[model samples]
Target chain A: MRTWTWLHKWSSLVCTLFMLLLCLTGLPLIFHHEIGELLGTEAHAPEMAADAPRVSLDRVMEVARARHPGKGGMFASQERDDDRVWYVTLSDTPTSETDLKQVAVDARSGEILTEPQLDNGFMYIMFSLHVNLFAGLPGMLFLGFMGLLLLVSLVSGAVLYAPFMRKLEFGSVRRERSPRVKWLDLHNLLGIVTLVWFFVVGFTGVLNTGADLLVQHWQNNQLAQMVAPYRGQPPLTRLGSLEAAVSAARAARPDMAVSFVAFPGTSFSSPHHYGIFMHGDSALTSRLLVPVLVDATTAQVTDTRELPWYFSALLISRPLHFGDYGGRPMQIIWALLDVLTIIVLVSGLYLWLRKHRAGAAKEAA
Target chain B: MSARRPLPHHGGRAHRHGRAHRHRPLWRWPVRLGVVTLVGLLSALLADGFWDVVSWLALGALVAVCVFFGWLRRG
Candidate 1:
């Protein structure tokens, strides 16, 4: 126990400054969805024409192709329900070395709605820094290591809490006493109250860090089974109308909703399958459904089961990690919890510094 | 002055057995339990979608394991 207490104090002080910056940046990211909506930048998918024959996916592609003639590549189409905008083509041009363009097209009229942009500038940068420190793989790995240390610190602190609070009731800050004692009390109070929130966010973050690797593994393993039969067959032709494909997909799984569609030849979809993703009917599953791979040639529904366990877990962990799943009220609660964490961090630093000062004075005397 | 009794330590309770074997071995038990529980958590998360009942169960089990150790200690 004494060893754990020492470990807790030293580990926390080691990463205290970096984590403080991370927490400050992370707070705003928790509310990013709401803030994006407020800023009028949230994109949505246009509602399908009711009783009016739907527009053709080929037509949308044609319009997009005509508008941007120099680039002929079209990767995939993404539908955003809230903003009613369709992101049609992902393209690269010769003049720019690393610029990839995402063309947003109106689903109904197939007209190009507006210029392409990153999801959100400020929020994306902050999120990148918090999660990976913008250093790519090394940064992600380092942050994961830090998260492990955090878990250790959390456990040790809890062990020490009983000794500190054996007498006082929960929530006693002891503000009138010595500064170190006050900080310790505050730390215990805040830590216990927000334990659930922190653990969920932190541990899920570890899962999130492994997401890309999981996706690659899924593509190689489970997806291999779905594509093996069609290995030598000519690539399946992409159907002309996505709305028709969506309706066909819904007919197969009446209870499911169309989450997204992968164009044939795309990475997720098989060369012979049109991956039409659908989520569960429940509130929780609705946000992270597994894709249903539909054979584009025959319009036959092939794979309906969610991605293999690890991939699905990564998908589901994203919302809890981001604090975006629980609606506006939950976001507010998350923000409050984030502030409490900041206080714990600062107070912890204060206590360490005060102790260091006292030790120095004693040595001088 | 009247003879005074020692004030009780509010921290961990005094073990009846000698200090060497009195309470559960702190480092071995908690560290091992924490590691096992952490693995279970990662496995459950991988097996099911996040937010499933399995993840919640894993979390509850973790906290219970921690609290159980804390309860075993004196004060």
Candidate 2:
């Protein structure tokens, strides 16, 4: 019991502040799409006839590239609910992760809608703080370590709960008692209540932090094998038609819709192929992606395969962490739970401080 | 705020009432709530509509329990 108490105190102290920041930032991020629409930054394609002749993906790419004169296309994707607009991301180089810009193009009319800001906005700030604290990969790993601490704290806290609650009934907050006692009961109640939730979200968050590493592994293993034939070939100077490549991918996976296409030389694609990711229409499978590699020069489907277990786990972890899976009600519940979590963190900190102060007072006397 | 103050004793009070008021097993309620919470978290992710509703209710039960204990009920 003493060891558990020591572990719980130290672990919770280490990660409490970061966890608080994450909960606060994550609250707003739960409604990111809604907030974006309200801010008028989200581009919506004008309504067109159901059977309207859609413009080719090539035309969409052209229009997006035209907006950013010298930038190379990195990715093109559409939202799951709205296929009317294609958002094309362009960077200085195909593989550059920074200084990227997005241009939204109407899929039917091939008209540029808006250049959505990739950085510097309310949601972006929240996202940066929540995801990586604006410090990129190192920051992400740091938070992941904090998340690990949070798990340790939670487990130790649970073990300690058995001792604390051995006498008191469940959820018995003796409010008439001292503030510390009230908060201690509240903490134990809310902590145990939110235990499973915090664990799921926290565990998935840890998994998501390893996303970049997992993708690199996939690139080295599966992607390298898929494009082995073109290992020594020079990068394609001129690419084949984007429309043809997409069409071939669609033909290859007739049951799935294209989620996004990673252009050649991007981190998500090899130098010789267009990594067109596809998704199923179901609620569950939509979160799981299947990658189809098409030859960038020939517009031919080179290889299509299911992602490895780790990659699929990373992909699934995204929605679980984001709380975007079950629609508006789920998002609201997620926010409420986040508020409750904030309470837990604050109360825990208070309990620790009060204990420390009392211990000091005792020594002084 | 005396550092040596006796911890608030609820077990004696419950025992004075009757055997019925005796504390339940320590892990009983926590385990039940944990299972409900686990169901709530996964149901929505697996499917929608009825499952989502199930998830909302299951999770909402925890919130409801918190409200009942923290605010509604008094010792």
Candidate 3:
């Protein structure tokens, strides 16, 4: 409809500048995974020998706690493919409140390879800035508004497309005329080609930025119910064997591998819960986490098995927005699309200015 | 602002019949409203200290200029 076209154009014109900025910054982010790999941040956890006795999770927990004596117990543990258990914990420093620490342990021998520390690196700092501009909640909400504007702009630009392209064909670029005409044509061509990717990036970005809200909702709703029965139950004094708990959980699932475990008393795992996180074999399914809750004392499986569709959508949107899901080829394609979007935004502004100037000249004549 | 507005004219130099002459008046109010709205938004964005304040100000000025052009074309 003409009305929709007008809405799209005006919206695009208003937000294209900001959208261009996001695209430029987002280009670097798509390759963050590859960059991390190149920077040697990837480490192999020691593998357990087939004949070696399996180390107890309690032993690994002991090493992690000894490293930070006065600190609280582990918040969660991540078991990598190479047999490393990453103990993520919280401890108070002399001057500050509780802070996060991640300690890597050899699962085969329960040896602490390194002391617990913050893992803030170059890529992480950039990632934080890109996501929230270091302004935290407000910045994320602002970016969401900008993303909304971009969606509007895309629609408006497409609407103006038919009117502008009525005479010219889809790919036509009028380079022979004034600079404005040439730029406008390029804008249209580039916008059309990259429309689908732009939509994917925009829609996913909205959902991704809304993750905090989603978590809070889940916590207030289902998580509350999961924890309700455990109320007034004796707080877990000492937890059960995590390996046994993980084995029990995997036995119940029959298909997934243990990716992480939230210990009792943590947010994800209440006094009533032992959050045994699992992943599927395939890449797509692997990204979807199914947190199986096991009773800490009895190692009895709770009803919390798989995530609902909304949560699954949220989980998948992270990779979709980042362009790391498919592979390096997808990253390259995302980067190219980002660059094209920048061109479209710049050219669109130029076209609008040129039209304004032409209108002024005609008025003077 | 009142002195700047051109007197409305029904016919122009290029027109043989008066039918094509009348439609130009319909563009006047829409152009003026669009320009003013654009300026208001541009000013708010500049006040917020988001990037491209200068471009936004320039955009505001452009819309103001377009408002003038619209007034000029009323005749």
Q: Residues A1-365, candidate 1, lDDT per residue (tens digit)? A: 56877888887877777667777888888877566667655554456754544467667667776776765433544532332446655555222324455676766777776645554477778878887888887898788777766667776776676556555654566666776876777677666645555666777777777776777788788777777777888754435455566667888888876666666766677776777777765655665666777776667777677677677667777866765544454455556556767777787888788888999999999
For residues A269-328, what per-residue lDDT tens digits would candidate 3 score against the true structure? 777567787877565566678878888778888755567688888987776577554344
Docking class of 1: incorrect
lDDT string for model 2 (A110-149, tens) is 9988889888889889999999999999999999999999
Q: What local lDDT does model 2 show for residue A68? A: 88
Query: Which structure is stronger by lDDT: 2 or 3?
Result: 2
Model 3 chain A worst lDDT window (10 residues): A89-98
TM-score of 1: 0.74
| TM-scores for all predictions | 0.74, 0.93, 0.71
Q: Which pairs clash in model 2? A: none
List, for all models, the DockQ compared with the true complex.
0.05, 0.35, 0.02
Better of 1 and 2 by lDDT: 2
**Worst ten-residue run, lDDT, model 2 chain A?**
A159-168
Which 10 successive residues of model 1 chain A have the least lDDT summed? Answer: A90-99
Whole-structure CA lDDT of model 3 = 0.64
- Decreasing TM-score order of the candidates: 2, 1, 3
